[model samples]
Target: HRFGITFHRNKRSKAAINTELETIPGIGEKTVIELLRHFRSVSKVKKASETALSEVIGPAKAKIIIKHYQQTTNEN
Candidate 1:
């Protein structure tokens, strides 16, 4: 199957999950590892505060992550 983007945590394929996160600006493989280590899951990451995320991924990337989620939130 072709690679696809998905926000749903139920996706069993790691490629799908990684592809989705990689779409977020500034989130590459290293950051993805950091995020997963810090938050364990996407839901946890989505609910994390900027300050908490900044501590994990630095404030700049934290802002990007927060903004990305916020924009996705507003769009829904």
Candidate 2:
């Protein structure tokens, strides 16, 4: 007889999860704080549409946030 082992992964929301969102390329504490201030949560930040993010973060930083979210989602 043969046996196999299996593993389980946790599927938690980004906002509830305490990931180091500040570590994303081009993001820092200030930007992170600003994002949190405007969005109030990581899930909201991650889910924000480009235009909405741009309105809150400005064009350059908004692009970075968008890229970070895309990259993080891909990693998950």
Candidate 3:
């Protein structure tokens, strides 16, 4: 607190959420932001179809994301 930085509860929550998304393979900050903006939540992003994700983040990135989720789902 000595640095005079104000603690924003909302930002802390957002950071935590972003961190969770980043755990998914091939998802970086920009990709996470795009997912958040498009799908609005981790579950939605996970549930998104390859085509839907491609619509938001492009085909290459979408394939990576879709594959990661598909692998995760298959493992469970």
Error (Å) of candidate 3 at residue 30 is: 1.1
lDDT (10s digit) by residue, model 1, range 5-68: 4433335455345545678977887798788877888789889999999999899999999999
TM-score winner:
1
Give me the displacement of residue 21 in model 1, in angstroms.
Answer: 2.0
- The pairs that clash in candidate 2 are none
1-76 in candidate 2: lDDT tens per residue?
1222222222223334444667787877667777788988888888889899888778888888788778877999
Candidate 1's C-alpha runs over 4 A off are: 1-19
RMSD of each: 8.2, 11.9, 3.6
Model 2 scores a C-alpha lDDT of 0.73
- Candidate 1 clashing pairs? none
What is the Cα-based lDDT of residue 39 in candidate 3? 85
List candidate 3 segments past 4 Å from native.
1-13
Candidate 3 lDDT over residue span 1-76, tens digit each? 6343445665656666545668777778888887888887888888889999889989998898877777877999
Better of 1 and 3 by TM-score: 1
